[model samples]
Target chain A: MEKKKTTIILFSGDYDKAMAAYIIANGAAAYDHEVTIFHTFWGLNALRKDENIEVKKGFMEKMFAKMMPRGADKMGLSKMHFAGMGPKMIKDVMKKHNAVPLPQLIEMAQEQDIKLVACTMTMDLLGLKEVELLDNIEYAGVAAYLADAEDGNVNLFI
Target chain B: MEKKKTTIILFSGDYDKAMAAYIIANGAAAYDHEVTIFHTFWGLNALRKDENIEVKKGFMEKMFAKMMPRGADKMGLSKMHFAGMGPKMIKDVMKKHNAVPLPQLIEMAQEQDIKLVACTMTMDLLGLKEVELLDNIEYAGVAAYLADAEDGNVNLFI
Candidate 1:
């Protein structure tokens, strides 16, 4: 079967886009197509091991401040969004829906063989050390995204 | 007066991002700032009057598909990552998080004077009609995004 080559470039870290990017990548995987997701800027947070990220208060806030993992305890989706409710509400929803949090989502992506790439330039500019990123994450540049996009992968700046 | 400019782009139909966009825009509005959202690709579905989405089946499948809108009823969210229960669980979590659904988020965006722009190129390529889009949605080109983005206002893609 001729598979559709697709690449989703996520330039965001917001929850909705993060979810959309994941869902789209999953759809591609389900279709048995080659898929790659390039995360940059706010998008880089998607590849982090952390969940329950707290958005910065405002301008001048450090990049990936809350998004970055504080440690294994705070890393890897330890906190799912309560959608603004307390942690208890977030947990309740998890129990009710049986939805896999971000960490699980990343695991599922890896298990499904979906490729995850991070933007090296953005990471460097933001002063992120590779060690600070998730273990499974791949680092690349615009050339990499272009290379994939040129392969007829659907390029999206999410 | 130097008005605060906030332009958030929505690229998927996921409830969380839509809700964030809504909340951020509303937040800006509350501060009397100008807010706008440019919707494209899957994000267009959020504005569709008839965006009736459905969840994918299977534990892995459902978890992966959780970020997508099953329909208008499931649009916008105050929560994220149902913690692996499923869509229903995700929704329950969303409710706990105080996340608004997509439709209500759209309504909120408008009520707060947030401009809604749809990417014309994407709509045509996707075979969508104006009717499929929500009312008051403006049709724009890449130039529009560039214009907005170049202005140095808060321009975010999703």
Candidate 2:
């Protein structure tokens, strides 16, 4: 029998939203499913390396890069932001509950061999360069995403 | 052959995100796939009735009801909110492009027989009553969502 396939389109930059996506993906992978997270738009911020990488860029690209979060740890919460207090509070609660952080979750996903693909189109639009993102991730477009999703048992756009 | 299934977890309350969810759901329905949109968390705001419906509620619930958008039209954008300018700008662009608004896309989904489900758990947490939401929609929990999603050809959390 073929393994079940799960494809998720991570489209949000929110810390909580990305956590939810990663949690679900990790759970699905634990169930022995072939999981893929196609990071797009703001979601690609989760794959960033948390440091500025000097690269040539136009004004708009530079603006976008400066405005967007540098990495998953820098992402804000989707709700109750409360002037940047929410993420800190959630982090405290997560630590108390022994829950893994978003960065660790991504590491686990990688260790489990879950495929992580960054959307090349959004990369250009957002001005994110290959060197700025984490290593060992594939880059592709919507056509490749649709190909994975069309045959997927579980396809989610997060 | 069994019909292909598409299930979405509409978890965001943003106007643009909800529009994306409805558009995808409507498209899947048009393709003859059985589709379900499980509205959870802030996503339930889309199903709210435009008019105020007086209902008994605790303090927290009342606060939730008051803070959340009354309906789809009242919801804000996820990005570039610009102190309420974003939604208006997007609506203007949508009008210029002859693009369907989120509310109409929802109506199209219903007409195409796409199942719209409100997550009962979140509804209760948010203090939303049955009379407050649009008519002809189903109310269910995560179990039902999982049942549909486990075999879903396309499952999205938008």
Candidate 3:
């Protein structure tokens, strides 16, 4: 039997959605599938540092970094977000359901040796610096994703 | 050659995320893959009728039905949804990009014979009636989804 491949395009920045992405990725890895998560655009927010990353950037880049969520913990809810309370509410619900937090899920995915890729084009467009992201991750462009996706047994854009 | 299978659990009701789900389903169907979209929980909102459904329900169910989005057209944005203007802004951007609207994408998926399954448990929990949904959709439980997913080449939760 050959090893199956799974490639995910993480495109949403919302906390709940990011949780879903990680849950699926982790599940796939558990099923013995080689999984790759390609983070792009808003999805890059999941990889950001929680604290202000001291990286030298241009004016617009600095502004973008300031405006966007610092990391997975800082992401907002997708909908029904009543004055920033919805995320807290959902987190409570998740805890009740024994679901792990999004940040921990990301760590688990890494521990499971799932390949995490950050989109370089999105980084350029959004002015995100490599120093601002989590360590031990791959960075590449769309072609790189397509190359993997074209042969992959499973491909998803979340 | 064997036909590939893809199953998507459409778990979010937000307009933009629903659009992404439909886009992926439509694309997969175009590629001649057997695709199944299992709409559950909040996802049932995407299948609702724009007008009052007029289904008799318990107090809580009625309240839920009233609170959720009526249909694809009435869905809120997943993020940055400020005073309902975010959806409008995104609609404009979609138009500029020549992206089809959510409702149209749903129609196209139906036309392409993609399997659209409304989760029966979710429907019961949310007080959604079949009469309130679009025509020609399947109703099933988690077993149905798991059956299709067991041999699926790709599985997604959006």
Q: What is the lDDT of residue A36 in candidate 3?
A: 90
Where model 1 places Cα greater than 4 Å from the true spot, the runs are A51-83, A86-94, B1-158
Q: What value of lDDT does candidate 3 attain over all alpha carbons?
A: 0.84
Clashing pairs in 2: A155-B155, A156-B155, A156-B156, A157-B156
Q: Over the stretch A1-158, how does candidate 2's per-residue lDDT look in tens digits?
A: 88887788999998877876786678778877788999999999999999889999999999999999999999998876767766786676566447688999999999989899999999998889999999999999999999987778877777
Give model 3's docking category: incorrect
- The C-alpha TM-scores of every prediction are 0.45, 0.63, 0.68
Write down the lDDT of every candidate, Cα atoms only. 0.61, 0.87, 0.84
DockQ of 2: 0.26
lDDT (Cα, tens digit) per residue for candidate 2, span B22-70: 9889999989999999998779999999999999987656766777899
Q: Which has the greatest TM-score? A: 3
Error of 3 at A77 (Å): 2.2
Sorted by TM-score (best first), the order is 3, 2, 1
lDDT of 1 at B4: 70
lDDT for A129 in candidate 1 is 56
Local lDDT at B119 for model 3 = 84
lDDT of 1 by residue, A107-139 (tens): 677888888898999876665556656777788
